[model samples]
Target: MTTLIETFAALSDPTRLDVIERLMAEGELPAGALVENTQMSAPAMSRHLKVLRHAGLVEQRVAGTSRLYSVRPEALKAIADWTMDHRTFWEAGMARLDAHLALEEGEGE
Candidate 1:
């Protein structure tokens, strides 16, 4: 779907990624809340949100005069699973880094 593709594109932007991270940490929030939390202009946050909504990564609902946005875990989970399928490369590197850190820590022990 176009939304799926758009979601990938939205997430690829650094600022948008930061937005996603914040929402993941804080849970659902109104659009203005996100703007305040991120210190982004309302218009900038609105544009970012538009991309996310188009990508189906977030759900929006009307709350009186405001629109509240929430992360759609299903979409994120799908992306996570898809990325995990090619996880070996990254995981292997992480395992090596873990071992390296452990060795350095043990040396200092």
Candidate 2:
């Protein structure tokens, strides 16, 4: 499995990001289907898929001659877990900022 840093790096590319978003929204898709929606050449799309697979963000299954790809739930869950772990800190900071903004607005009024 790839680390969080690798996952983030893979998703940093717009093409790979689009692929991840599509798989999450549309569920499992074959390689050919993914190519159809993009302006990228088939080879370029394949390379992006390879990067996603290596980063553990997506998994591929062989169905006869075709390769089907889908977002790995565990991978996505890992990201969610990381964010939730930091939730309290950011939430508190945002609340403080919101309060400050409210005070400023009241003073302006």
Best by lDDT: 2
What candidate 2 gets wrong by more than 4 Å, as runs, is none
lDDT of 2 by residue, 10-65 (tens): 98999888889999999999999999987879999998899999989999999998
lDDT per residue (tens digit) for residues 1-109 in model 1:
5444666888999877877887798887888888876656899989998888888788899989999888888888878887798799899999999999999999995
The lDDT for every candidate, in the order shown, is: 0.83, 0.92
Model 2, C-alpha of 107: deviation from truth (Å): 1.3
**TM-score of each prediction:** 0.71, 0.94
Pick out the ten consecutive residues of candidate 1 with the lowest summed lDDT: 1-10
As a whole number from 0 to 100, the lDDT of residue 96 in candidate 1 is 100
Could you tell me the TM-score of candidate 1? 0.71
